[model samples]
Target: MSIQVGDRLPEVVLKRIHEGIESVDTRALFDGRKAVLFAVPGAFTPTCSEKHLPGFVEHFQQFRDKGIEVACMAVNDPFVMQAWAKSQHVPEGMMMLSDGNGDFTRALGLELDASAYGMGLRSKRFALYAEDGVVKQLHVEAPGEYKVSSAEYLLESL
Candidate 1:
């Protein structure tokens, strides 16, 4: 089953373009802070590029104002995540995490198989709120649908 409210996030290493593809530990990122980690199946796909990530980019300050740090996760490499951040005009302080090998995705039980579409292992579209390492709220989208995971919806929920 997927990670639920009250579950402590599994420890994993994710990559980001901080001075050139730094590896970050999940515990260090989430522990002792309020954070929202939202995942997309793949970077630059239509829905994810046009709407999902942009919503977060547009609302990044709002989330920060509430004392919650935001991070966007995808199954792409750190390079792609970096490029996407640039393309989206993502502001600083919002993390663009690269799952790279889907290890973290599988640990959370949120892995998506897209072999038929030529993409292999990926993450399902989802967003989760956590406080000090434990999940407080999670909104995972139904396949081929989008709603609860949007930044606007998550802001309203908070």
Candidate 2:
């Protein structure tokens, strides 16, 4: 079953690009905080690069102002995620987390199989608002749809 409001996010390790090599615990990222976590199919893809990620990047400050931490996840390597964040001009305070092995995605029961497109296992586009590691709301997009996971949707939900 898909994760829902009131669910505690699973514990998973994610690779992060920091000063050197750094691994982050997914639960630790959300523990004791309100956070908006969004997942995309891949990094550097057209919609993700042009719209999905930019929407969050543009509204990151507003999210923080509302006392929420914002994070983006993709089933790509840390190096690729880092490059994509730089290319998208991600501001400080927004985290671009790499679910490189898809462990986190699977743990959330949100993994998408896109092998037909040669993308392998990926994440469905979705957003979640969580408080102290428990989800408060979830917005999961229908396949090929982008209506629900946008920054506007998240802001309104908040």
Candidate 3:
């Protein structure tokens, strides 16, 4: 089953893009704080590029103001995720985590087989609100749907 509210996030090493690629632990990110962790099926897709990412980019400050650390995770490599961040002009404060091998994705039970769509194993579109390593809210979208996972809705849910 997919992760649910009140479930502790699995300890997984997510790749992060910086000057060099860094492996970050999931627990280190969420421990002792509130955070918004949202995932997309792939980077640079139409909806994800035009809407999903920008929504978070636009509201990042507000999320920060509320003391919530926001990060975007995808099933791409660090290079691609970093390139997408640069293309979108994403702020430095927001993290672009790469689940390069889909380890974290599978651990969360949110992996989607998108070979038909040209992408292989990937994360389903979802948004998670976690506090101190435990989830407080989880929103998984229906296939090809974007309603519940947008940043605006996350703000409302928060």
Candidate 4:
């Protein structure tokens, strides 16, 4: 089943290119703070690059001002995520997470099979708000739609 409000985020390790491809544990990352984790189907895709990530990068301060840490996740490897972040000028503290194996995406039941489009297993466009590891809000976009999970929408909903 897909994760819902009130569900605790599953235990999973996601990667990021910090010093050198650091591993981040979900529980440790969200256990003591409020955080917004937004997932993209793939990094550098049209919609993802043109709109999705830019919105988050633009409004990253607002979320932080409200005491929430923001993270962007994708099924791509940490190297791709790092390149995308640099190209987009993503803020320093905003995390770029890589679910390379799709393990975390499957664990959340949010995996998307985009094989027909030449992309293999991936994550749906979705965002969730969690406090101390418990989900408080989840915005999962319909297939091929981008509305609820947008940074503006998530900000207003908060």
Candidate 5:
């Protein structure tokens, strides 16, 4: 089953590209933190570009002011995620993570088989609010839908 409120995230090492690629364990990252962990199907796709990512980038500070760490995840490789983040001007407070092998996404049961779209093994668009590694709220979009997981929606929930 997919993750639900009160569920602690599964253990997985996600990649973050900096001067070089580095792996961050999800359990470690979420420990003792209230974080908004969001996933996109792919970086630079239309919705992710125009709405999803920009929403988070724009509201990152508000989240931080509320004592929440914000992170964005994609099924793309670390390089692509880094490049996309630069192009979008993702703030320092927001993390850009890559689930390159789909391990984290699959582990969350949110993997999307996008072979029909030629993207392959992407993540579904979703956002979850986690407190000290336990899920507090989860906003998972229906296929092709965009209403639930946006930053505005998540902010309202918070």
Candidate 6:
């Protein structure tokens, strides 16, 4: 089932490109803190690269000012995520996390099979606002839709 508001985020370790790898225990990252976790289908895709991730990057400071740590996740490997972040010039406040094996996505029940688009298994575009590891709000976009999970929407929810 799709994760819902009030659900405790699943504990998982996701890889990141920064040499100091982030072996995140979801509870450790979210429990005792406010965070905005957003997911995309894959790294470097046109819509995701040009729009989704950039939206977070652009408004990262606003999120921080609101006491929200922002994280972006995709199904790509760490290397790809790192490269994509670098290319996109992702600012320091935003973390690019990799769910390369799709374990975290599966756990959230947000995995999307895009083989028809030649993308294999990926994450559906969604965003969650969590405080103390429990979700406070969740926004999920319909396939090919970008309205709900946008930074503006998330910020409004916060």
**Segments in model 1 whose C-alpha atoms lie over 4 Å from true places:** none
Alpha-carbon shift of residue 39 in model 2 (angstroms)? 0.6
Backbone clashes in model 6, listed as residue pairs: none
**Positional deviation of 17 in candidate 5, in angstroms?**
1.3
lDDT of 4 at 135: 97
Model 2: lowest-lDDT 10 consecutive positions: 19-28
lDDT of 2 by residue, 119-146 (tens): 9999999999999999899999999989
Q: How high a TM-score does candidate 2 get? A: 0.98
Report the C-alpha displacement of residue 122, candidate 6, in angstroms: 0.4
> Candidate 4's error at 56, in angstroms?
0.5
User: How high is the CA lDDT of each candidate model?
Assistant: 0.96, 0.93, 0.94, 0.97, 0.93, 0.89
Off by over 4 Å in 6: 20-22
Clash totals in order: 0, 0, 0, 0, 0, 0
Q: Which stretches of candidate 5 lie over 4 Å from their true place?
A: none
Residue 154 miss distance in model 1 (angstroms): 0.5
Instruction: Return the lDDT, model 3, position 37.
Output: 94
> Can you write out model 4's per-residue Cα lDDT over 1-158, one digit (the tens) per residue?
99989999999999999999899999988999999999999999999999999999999999999999999999999999999999999999999999999999999999999999999999999999999999999999999999999999999999
Q: Could you give candidate 6's per-residue lDDT for residues 1-158 as a string of tens digits?
A: 97889898998878886666667666776789999999999888889988999899989999999989999999998889889998999998688888988998999989999999998999999999999889899998999999889998888877
Q: Indicate whether candidate 5 or candidate 6 has the larger lDDT.
A: 5
lDDT of 5: 0.93
Question: What TM-score fits each model?
Answer: 0.99, 0.98, 0.98, 0.99, 0.98, 0.95
Error of 1 at 39 (Å): 0.4
The better-scoring model by lDDT among 4 and 6 is 4
Give the least accurate 10-residue stretch of model 6, judged by summed lDDT. Answer: 17-26
Q: Arrange candidates by lDDT, descending.
A: 4, 1, 3, 5, 2, 6
Write the residue-wise lDDT of candidate 3 on 50-122 in tens digits. 9999999999999999999999999999999999999999998899999999999999999999999789999
The model with the greater TM-score, 1 or 6, is 1
